[model samples]
Target: MLNIMELQQILPQEYPFLLIDRVLELDEGKRIVAIKNVTANEHFFVGHFPGLPVMPGVLILEAMAQTAIVLYAKTKHVDKNMVRYYFAKAEIKFKAPVVPGDVLQIEVEAEKMLSTGGILKAVASVEGKTVAESVIGFSVKNIREDKT
Candidate 1:
């Protein structure tokens, strides 16, 4: 299992933006299982819904993407600083409202990988109930500090 700190080595997301909390399982290019602990203290809740806050569906997708990145990094053996992964597409379905105190389980499976692009299918669930699922298409590109 990889903790948040270790995950930071594979992903560029920071606080308030880092959606994945921990990685429960990882199999390089094949599959991964991650966790995201949604808390009422999340900043988005302030506007997402003032009183009855619900975890935004987009964030759930972000968590899934992060997990995919970890898998990619491990498989490619590339340092996070040397490369970056961008979401090419995301087809997501929100099935339930994710509230604070919910522990979201994110599972991702790599469907295909190529030099120019790749595809990953993922799902987020809470208490055995699916909250969201998405198939994300992404590409990997070299990172140049001065070119961004």
Candidate 2:
């Protein structure tokens, strides 16, 4: 159970880039459930479309990736103080359109763990309708003490 502020502290993303709004459920090394409140006021709506604003499909996938990254970070014991999860790859399919004023429910289930990263299955839904789903991959990298 984590709120936006709490999530920000744990997740590296900030402001507009941080996609997930709240973490509803988390089972270490298993699954995670999160939510993102898409609003008409979002910055993307201005450029994506002026008359009919639509939440970009890529953003939906990013939301799922964020959800899975957080799950991996928490479960793998990757020290947040020293490590960050990098967006490696994603195989996703979109079933419906997500629009402004929709609360996206993102659910991720851990499928496999690699030596340097892991894979996860994620889904985003709106009002019981599946909007998007994906198999996401991410890698953990520790902060470099010296960058030369």
**Top candidate by lDDT:** 1
The RMSD of every model to the true structure, in order and in angstroms, is 1.7, 1.9
Runs of candidate 1 with Cα error greater than 4 angstroms are 144-148
For model 2, residues 1-86, the per-residue Cα lDDT tens digits are 98998788777778898999999999988999999999989988998887989899998988898888778877876666777677
The TM-score obtained by model 1 is 0.93
In order, what lDDT does every prediction score? 0.87, 0.86
Candidate 2 — which residues are off by over 4 angstroms? 145-148
TM-scores of all candidate predictions against the true structure: 0.93, 0.92
Q: How does model 1 fare in lDDT? A: 0.87
Clashes of 2: 0
Model 1, 36-127: lDDT tens digits are 99898999899988889998888888888888888888788778777767787999999999999999999999999775558999989999
Worst 10 residues of 1 by lDDT: 139-148
